[model samples]
Target: MSQPSVYPSVSPGDPSWWFSDALRAEGGEKPSPSLSGQITVDVAIVGGGFTGLWTALALRERAPQLSIALIEASLCGSGASGKNGGKVHGYWASLAGMAANIGADGALAVARAGTRAQDAIRAFATVPGRDVWWRESGNVRVSAAPAQDAKIQLYVETAKRLGVPDTAQALTPEQVADYCRSPVFRGGLYLPEGANVHPARLARALRKAAIEAGVGIYENTPMTGLTPGSPNRIATAAGEIIAREVVLATNIELAKRPEVSRHVSVFSSYALMTAPAPEKLAAIGWNRDQGLADLRMFVHYFRKTVDGRILMGSGSGPISFAGNTKNPALTTDRASAARAEKGLRRLLPGFADVPVEKVWGGGIDVSSDRLPFFRTVAGTRIHYGAGYSGHGVNPTYMGGQCLASLVLGVKDEWSTLPLCTRDVPKLPPEPFRAVGGRLVRWGIIGCEEAEERGVQAGVMMRGAAAIPKVFGLRIGTR
Candidate 1:
């Protein structure tokens, strides 16, 4: 099959108004070309979203004298960085999964790095002109069924053992009902360190900050290829950038680059935002404003937007290799929307009438172990950081900082984390990749079906409980 198109067409007048509203509110400028062409810089960064912007900012702070340039394929944050769920929470997936690949000690180190990354983002929010809709409210992972309760318990214990300083409390059924306003959740594990953000605004703010700090940024400039040698040269459609070093911050988009395609796979995830939910909130009695996620292999994560709308996200489907090939027929399809809407109603049946005002989908980079891959491609000054799994918001910032430190030849706390190294293995090729993803999706669906039945009966059945581990996955514990 021919490669999928890299650019999918998006409607400018869609009901999904977050991107346009955010751009206007943030006073973001339109993309422009770099004035000085063929200029040499200390570092040349590809991808001007959060990863590249953060990398530039961190590097500037560390080595003020170094010159840097950031090239964007489109506008900054126009990709997944801006379109994500905006939950800047803890580490990706589970520590158990990370430990399975990188060992327990390494996993703990990675978790600590993530925690520090979240702290760093919070600190960045305090800067004037850099503030985005940042709510320091914690995150809660609710159990959709009794069997899933075990998964939450496992997370709580794992957090403690990993030396995570945040409080992980298991809420009782009564507490879940009172706080979450959802009767379907038997309980949940609440962590105090989590936060929600306006992803688009944050990306714009970071790019703005980097530009103000004397970093050169070029937009609508796509890097098509790379030439590695003593000094790396990045080829764009219009021109080439020759710099002492280069960084690849393109997460899922990395699949478009032949050099990095082996290390990343593109997977599509869909999200929906309900119309203003004041009435729904009143009925649910959940005004505390914590980000909520469910415990499942393919999970649902929702959070309250600043405008009082609830953003719900679900659905992980395989997409064509070409980046822009979306089946509009599949966008907000009944089955996918039902996964999110049903999850919301289960938590707050009182809000079952809330209409979904907007639905959008984006792609994520998935690595073999569901952990991020950060490394310098062998014998070259080109450093890369991608494969954040589904947890890119906070980790992207952290990964950027680590990339900055690595480029500067500094060994700091974040740089020392095991995830910063080039140790994680690459995933299998296309056919096997497609097969493995299908198996994972089947396992997750089976578990969700079992839980729905058990919840209706008010007890977990033995047959319903064994789906996750039997399929080589981790489920949170009771």
Candidate 2:
């Protein structure tokens, strides 16, 4: 296949440009090219988004003299890292689900590491020229229906058992209305550790800090192939890099390469930002700033931007092969924005008239279990971390640190996290993969709808609704 134009350009230059705008506004020392052609480095990191940049930064801090090279297929932050909902909340995926695969101790270790990761991000924000609109106010997960409220309760109870300090507290219906202005919400959980940041700005700042610390970064450099031997060589469009260790931080983009395609699946997520909602911000008391997410299977996540706009996101529908490979597309279909707007209006009715100023979409790597995949590729010195399952912002920061520690042979707190050697089962082939994705999405939709109707919705009901249509099985419910 011919190489595609992955370079990020600003307005009038590229159709996908919101992330580039955010980066330019943050101001950073532009990364210099990797001009010294055939160079040797202690570590060579592919994919210059959050994972790659964070890994490079952490490695430099640990061993400043270790040579490192970071390469980006496009500009840094061009992936989901830049285009996500900007809610740096705690991991929303079920810890119990992860524990089922990795033991309870393993799950707790990951959660504790996430806490540390959030702290690391905040610490990074404090450095001069690296500030990126970090907001420390916590995140509130609202429950849109009564059945969903049950799950939120279970989540709170589980958090306490896991020794999570300040376990999410339940809000009374009145309290929910007072805080969220959403009468539709029965109750919700308030988590104190969650925070939000401008992801694009943060990614660029990380890249700048890494470069200043002597890490070489090359933009518009795609790793086409790799030869994994004693001193692994990574071949790119323009040149090749030889390094003692390699870190694959490509995430969803990993599917483009045959080496990782079997290990992950790419899913598209779409988001929209409204023109500044000053009046609405004042009405909801969100002027203090807190991110918000809901309890539905296809959840809605929203946050108050420093610029006074409400950034809301949803829609993770399966896309066709062509759609998946093409540039990001902004669509008014599926009524996602309207659905998001309705949810937002429930939270702050004052913004019912606020017009959406921008809409963008990006891809996330999702494993079958919905937990992150962190492991070394077999037969290679390459270490990889991907499949964050739509929770990458904070986790990626911590994951990067962990990856760096592993690469540098430092056994620290990050190094002890369950991520280092976890193995995710390989996904089935393309047609099956696509079919399974649609089935899962459909099942989720059915369950959500049934729950809204006050019906008891179970996993069996979800499976029954979708299995025959997509999976070609009856698989009678247990």
Best by TM-score: 1
Q: Quote each prediction's TM-score.
A: 0.87, 0.86
Q: What is the lDDT, from 0 to 100, of the residue 478 in candidate 2?
A: 10
Candidate 1 structure quality by residue, lDDT tens digits, 355-408: 666666666776656777677777889888877877888888888888997787
Off by over 4 Å in 2: 1-18, 24-31, 34-36, 256-259, 319-349, 410-412, 449-478
lDDT of 2: 0.70
| lDDT by residue (tens digit), candidate 2, 231-300 | 9999987688999999989877666766566756666666667787677777755556667878876777
Q: Which residue pairs of candidate 2 clash?
A: none
